[model samples]
Each structure stands twice: as C-alpha cells, then as structure tokens.
Target: MDIIDNLNAVKRGKLSRRAFNRSLLAAGVGLFSAPLLPRKALAAEGDHPTFFTWGGFDIGELYQPYEAANGALPNFSIFGGTEEALTKMRGGFVVDAAHPCNVGLKRWVDSGLFQPVDTSRLANWGDVMPELVAMQGNDNGAGSPWMVPFDWGGTSITYRTDIFELEGEESWDMLWDERYAGRLGSLASGGDAWWCGAIKAGVDFKDIATDMAFEKIAAELRAQRPLIRVYTDDTTTLEQALASGEMAAAMTWNSSAVLLQSEEVPVKFAKPKEGQLTWVCGIMIHKDAPNLEKTYEMIDAMLSVETGKFMINDYGYGHSNLKAFDEFDEDTLKSLGLSKNPAAILDEGHFMIPQSQDWESRMNETFELVKAGF
Candidate 1:
C-alpha cells in the first residue's frame, strides 16, 4: 500500500503515524523535505475536500500528506477528459480541485471557475518546471499562476516490435501503413487524434488554427480510416490488443509502453521523426473551494517530489518537480524513452496548444464522419 493508505490505517487507530512515516522514508518516498503539518491544525476528521480529476489519479498515493494530517482521504470523482470535467462544473458539480492540462489552461482560466494559486503556499512551487508553469495565458500578466503542472507524457505509437517492422526511418506514417490495415487503432477523441493527425500531415502545430491546416488534418485522418481497426480513448484496451498480437500497433501514450513491458510484452514506444505529441496535466483550485486549506494542502502534496517520483517511475511520465529527476539516472530515463529534461520533449515534440471550443466541436464532428467511412 502507498502512504495515504497507511495514513488511513492510522486514522482508524489501526496504525501509528510515526511508524507509517518511518516506513515511507524507508521506501524512499520523500526525496525532498515536506514538513508535516501539526495534526491539531488540520481540518476536522470528517471534513474532506473533493477532487475532480482523471480516472487513474483518484488514489491514495497522490494525497498521502493530506490524509495523514486530516485523517481522511479527499472525496474523489473521475472525468474522462478535461472538457467533460469543465462542462460538469459549469453545470454545478462543485469540486475543490480539478485536473487539467496545458492545452486547457487558457479555457479553464477563462471559465472563471478557478482562482489563481498562491505559489508561496506550495512548498514545492519553486521546483516546478517553468516551461510547464508558464504555459500560454497561465501567467495572466498579473503575476498570478493559473495552473500547477504535475504530470507529463508523450502521445505516440506503441507497436509490437516482434510483429511490426518499419521499412524506413520511424515516423507517424506507420499508423497510416496499408500493411497494418484492420490491425491498428487510434484514440477516438479529436482533441488527441486531430493533433496527432496534424503532426502526421506535416502541419506545424502552431498553424493548427488555420483553415488550410484543418483541411490537411481532416484529409490525412480520412485517408487513415481504412487502416485502423478501432478507435478508442481507452489505453488499456489498446495495450491488451497489442500484447495479445491482435494489433500490430496503435496510437498510445508513454504509459502503455511501460505497462506492457512490465507484463513482459514485446513492445516499443516510437519517437517518431515527425515528433511525439507531448502534454502537461496539472491541478487547479475551484474559485469557491469549500475546504480551501485542505485543497491547498492537497495541491502541495501532489507537487511534492514524492508524488513526482511516483508519477515518473510508476506511471512512465515526467514529473513537474525538478528533484524527481535526481532520483533516476540519465540511462534509466532513456531506457524508458524519457528524457531527464522535460524541455527535450516540450521543445522538440508537438506540444498541444489551446484552440477555440468551436474548433474542437467541428473536429469531432468531422472525425465522426471519417470514422463512419465517409
């Protein structure tokens, strides 16, 4: 079990906090010092903040410090995408904190559902990668930070190396290969597949807002439809297909590669010549968080080096904390197809940028037509 689970045991009077903390140190959970808040000053035992985040993040490990201090885990809910989460909040689903990525930074801030975070309260704020923290529109020209980047990873092809062989330099073209027809997959969401399709179409990410770029991306994806066996947002389903040799390859993120390898599957995550699709996901406090102090503590816990290490080592993603890089050697990171420097991916890959919501609607509608063999 992770730290938060152990802390829950302590809260139930089944374990001691001191003993659990010692075990955490023994397991190398704390790479940077985060002094524990006095238990007496923490929120009341029954007062827990609510977190609205991605599916896999509603776990104990990410919020260990808060659970230990407050003696209860934060109430949690999961959203499949940031856009869906935003719509839910707009419809009156109140949460203390929500997870969004750099691509959604502008839209999330513009919604006015969130307030700027006081970095001073975040003990690990200084260690956050500036490239991630300074995403477009996040600085707001008023010295306030709008989002706190926590996790980052790449969107690229994961292929069965034992079954698939490239004829030339690795590129996104593999997804369009006729040889893999009826044996390949791609994400169903336009938010991801559209950008990746743009990369394959040779459209510069910066020009994605233009009509010419949209036409190019749409044409490329339409051409690619005959080759794809399925389209889904579920990475696990894709991973299972690749592992069972049912799929030769699929559009996937870094985690698929890590999870597949651990299960002893012969797979490789491509670093395509066209560039990988890189993204950064982070946390934002609701404008009217009912439990503001608990929410602040939860965000700080997520930014801690401990959580950063878990994110990188366990989930196969880059952490926002600089100290997390210190835990792994350059060789180790390279073996996992990651760079010790997040800038390598952010600067070199096809990092996503915010687009008008109307663009997203149009792209999704167009993609649906393509998927239906238009």
Candidate 2:
C-alpha cells in the first residue's frame, strides 16, 4: 500500500501507528511530511511545551488531555533511539520533557539535565502502578520519581513460526543457532543487545559491570556476529525481513510480533527459556524546561487512563496505570503477553539494571567492535 493508504488505515484503526510509520519510511516519506492535526487548531510552535520522544509517540492520540487543557498538542521532537535522545540533550538541545527507559534512569539523572517529576501535579498519579514507580533509580528521595513510568514491555525473539524449526523449548540459543547462520537478525543498540547477550552468556545482570561479565558478553556477541544478517535499531527492517522469509528469527520488541500477527505473519514473540529483556520507559522533565507547567500537563496526559488504554490496546504495551488493565480480560492480556498484575510478567523477565556511564560507554564500544567482526 502507498503512504496515504497506510496513514488512512492508521486513522481508521486498521493499522498501528508504528506500522504506518514503517510504511512511511519504506516509501521514503518523512514522518513530519504531513501534519497530524489541522493547521488551524495548532498553537504557535514555541507556545507549546516540547516533547522529545520516539517517532511513533509523537501522535496526537497520546496527548488528548494535554490538547483539551491547552487547545493544542505539545510540540514534538522525534528521536530514533534513547541514546540518540540523551546525546542530543547533553549537547544542549533542550526540551520540556524527554522520554527515556528505566535502564538509562541512573545515567540520565546523573547528567544533571533533568528534574524529578512532581506526582501531585499529575491527576492520574493515584492510578499509576506502584511496581513501575518503584523501579530502580526512579525515586527522587523526596517521595517523587525521576521519571513517570509510561510504557513497559519485553524485548525477545520474534521468530517466524512457520520457518524456524524449534529443536526444543524456545531458548535464547535460537538466535545463535548455526543452522540459521545467515538468516538471523538483531538490534544494534548495546542497551538491548548487550543485556540480551548477558542472558545468553549466563552473566547475571547484577554483575554486568564486572570485568568477567563484560568479557563473557563480548565473547558471546562476537561468536554470534557471523550469524547475524543485520543488526539494526529499525524495527521496520527486521519486520520486513521476517515477513519476506529473508530472516528466520530476530530479536524484537512486543509491538513487532503484534504488528506481524495483524498481517497474518506466522510469528511468535518467544518466551525464551533463559528469559526475555524487559523495560519500563517514561517521561522526565528537563531541569531547564522552558514551559514547566505545560510539561507537567504533558506528563499528566501521558499518565491518563485514555492514553494508557491506547498504549495497552494499540501498541500491545503494558501501561503504568492500574486501571488500564481493566479494559482487557485475562485471556486478552495473556495473548498480548501481559498480565493484570504486571509483576507476573516483569518479575519473570530479566529487567535491565541501571549501569554507570563508564560501563555503558565500554559496553557500546566493545559491542560495536564485535559487530564489526573484529
């Protein structure tokens, strides 16, 4: 389908925002080439708080409350990945609020570029999940969190069930199988690949910073390098590869399997025997926010049940609001690989631990070299 057809499908709920975005990229269309809202309704760009977030999240659906309160959505700046977002912010490209996941919580906080979110200003704070709020490095030492948890989900194998021959119960070894050497794919980001490597290498995340863990993980990645057909952060590439049977299996997030399933792709989001990498991502206000009050509103909107429902239903992600689960039955939640009690899924998965900046730099550098076949 063409980009216009894909976009119309998104508006009609026949396609997901992420899938539509992938279609746009495939058609060489920039995400911002068309405005999401009518030009007349939008406030002046500078009048609204800037929300720097991932591409799919810049949509107006997540900002309903913010729009209702201010008659316009927050200005948006899209980033391909969290690392890119952080690097841009560190370079003095400021936004009122930025989206970041739990693994980077400590490093982002230590950057001294963000401030703790005040829960009192958020109307939906009471309905927010305590387990998410209690994630490592979220506390601000004053009964508030550094980041207000938004979406949570797993990162694991999204393999073509029809093409991949399962020799045993699903395991992380699926990605390393020599039988599929030239047809496997993986995410390039060390934030994800390195953590998954630790799982595959039997290196405990608690000790991931240790020299032993680094060596083990690096060796595991290097061993798997030749097996990977591609290592990219773009979900579209992986999805397209899987759809065409060019790839047998790939590491992907929850939405990938969900999107593939919608298109009748015989795929499964694997619950590996070792474990899947899990994460919680949320919004953090900049310390020098230009529109401080609206920033709070933007965060509040994200935390609302309306936004939560969309996130849970459309994106197949677990929303931080407890009530968001009320909209789905147990079977429905199970199909999405989520549970009403999020701890059921989160606790069993290998939740990423916060790491020091030095450790992050070292891991990325080492992983890059390994990807280079060194």
Candidate 3:
C-alpha cells in the first residue's frame, strides 16, 4: 500500500496517521520533519509563485509561454514518482503545484491534499478539451479542482520498418522477433514494463493478479533481456541508440515514435495485436500549494488550442485539447502517423497503475520478479 492509501485507511480507522506517515518516510519517497501536530498553511503573499515537478515532465515544450504569461519562472524539483510527489505535498511544502497522472488522481483527491481549481479564474477552460476536463475528477463549480490531464500518449513499440518484411502490420509479437536481437530496448520502470508484459501475455489488465499471469510476463522479459541493449526511461537516449543503429527497435511513448518518424528514422509506432499501454500524466494544484493564483493562470495558458497545436506538432501523442487533432492537414497527419483511429486499439490498451495499495504492493513485487529474472 502507498502512503496516501494508508492515510485513507487511517481516516477510516484502519491505521493511524502517525503510522502511515512514518511508513511513508521509511519508503524513501520523502520525509517531513515536523512536530506531530497538524497546522494548515495559508496562501503566500506573492505575484508569481514557484513551481516544482520532475524536470523533463514539466519543461521542454511550454516553458516559455507559461513563464512569459505568468511573469515568473517555475522553480522545479524533480519527483521520481507519484508516490514521491504526494510525499512532498503531505508536508504542505512551498511549490505552487505538482504534476502526476490520471491513475494517481483519485488518491490525490481523497487525501484532501489538493484544492479544486476555480473555474471562473480560468480563461482557457472553455478553450480546453472536454474529456480532459471530465478527467479532472469532479467539479465543485467554484474551488480549485483536482488534477488536470496534461500530456498523454500510449506506451507502444517503435520498430524499424526495415526490420519487418510486412508493411502496415503491427503487433506485440514483433518485439520478440529475433531479427532485432541485441538491438531492442525496453523502459526500465516497473510500472511500464509490467503493463507491457501483461499485454503481451494476453492477460486482461484488471485481472493481472494471478501468479501464472505475472510469471509468464517475467519469463518473457527474462528471455528478452539477453537481447536487450539496456533498460532506460530516457526516450532521447533511445532515439540516439536507434539513430546510431545501436538498437533497431524500442518500446517507447507513441510521441517518441512521432518524433522519430518526423526525422525520418525508418521507425513506425505500432499497436501490436496484443494491444498497447496508454498513459496521461496530470497537473494538480497541491493543497496549501504555493502561488495559488499563478498556478491557475499557467494551467489556463496550457489549455489553449494554440498551445495544443505546438504540442501535437512537436510530440506524437493525441492532444489534451480536442481541437488539436484538426490542426494538421491530411498529408502531415499521415506523415506523422497521427491519422490513426485511436479507439481501434484503445479498447486493447492497459489501465494506469491501480489506485489501491494492495494492488500496488503486488505490482511492485511482480515487477521485482521480472527484474531479478526469477
């Protein structure tokens, strides 16, 4: 179980908050040195407030627009996981906001760890997409809403078309093909690898707790490890490897595939017959979040179609803004593989991480099994 789940259990009389927080710190996600008393913090007096999140997650694309519109640059501290992001927020720290994903949405909201964003304060809410707003959880009509869906994409295989003889054919079985031996790469994260393994084994994502199922995934991974160049989370590194011919294929974000195809890397994003894994990382306003007003403004700026166009033009994933799909002409869309019928494969994709603690623990253990080659 994660810290937030434990805290919820404490709220419902299953565990004590002291115990939860103690266990949380022991997990090495974060630590809060404080008197055991709860003290609520008021908003800080400032025009522009600091922003903190994982370095690559927040920067790179929208930095300039956000900074210019808000009159201050974001002050960032990279959190390695959603668990770590929550650990820092539990202490009422200073950053105005933090970014997590839709999977962690319910847990963050249930903890009272964040405030609902005021809709009226946002000029771009209407300009933003509907599904993205609905994803924010619930609307209270006035306060700060929970997390907002930011960038999104599928966890898919980007294979060299030259390696596969069949054209326009995509399937999970392609990765296990021996043609790319010593030239394939997979993400090192437990969450990503587990999802891929589950998909490959034909186990229904929600029904993935059985030992037989996970064992199959681990076995498959262990079998592939010898052929894998290395496990990495950095897509840029993967791109370099692919370009340099160090790896002929990689399991990467669909956007990475888009970037590669744009550069004419002989790569194509594929949704294998076994399906694909998708994810939408989110941005949420932390309760007692620093720079409450500025945080909303930044989010509003990001919600614009103009900004969405920039993201789609640069990244391969479908935009959080609905209108982004129409931003490009047919030829451009085909060139970038953006013309895909996303739903045809979405029914086959896996879910984000489980919100329950028991499931997360089991997932971590199952992941260890794969990593250790058990």
Ranking by lDDT: 2, 1, 3
lDDT (Cα, tens digit) per residue for candidate 3, span 214-248:
67777777777667777877666776666555677
TM-score of each: 0.87, 0.91, 0.76
Candidate 1 accuracy as TM-score: 0.87
The local distance difference test score of model 1 is 0.81
Report how far off residue 351 is in candidate 2 (Å).
0.8
The CA-based lDDT of model 2 is what? 0.86
Better of 1 and 2 by TM-score: 2
Clashes of each: 0, 0, 9
lDDT by candidate, in order shown? 0.81, 0.86, 0.64
Q: Pick by lDDT: which candidate is best?
A: 2
| Whole-model alpha-carbon lDDT for candidate 3 | 0.64
Model 2 agreement with the true structure over 61-135: per-residue lDDT tens digits? 788888888887888888988888999999999889999999999999999999888788888999988988899
Per-residue C-alpha lDDT of model 1 across residues 1-374, encoded as one tens digit per residue: 48777767766777654455446545644311122222332223355788888866766667777777767777787798888999999999898999988877777888889998888898888999998887777886779888888898889999999999898878899999999899999988887898999998999878987999989998999999999999998776787678678899999888878767755668899989888998888888899889888888888888888887777776788889989888999987886777777687678788899776777778778888988898
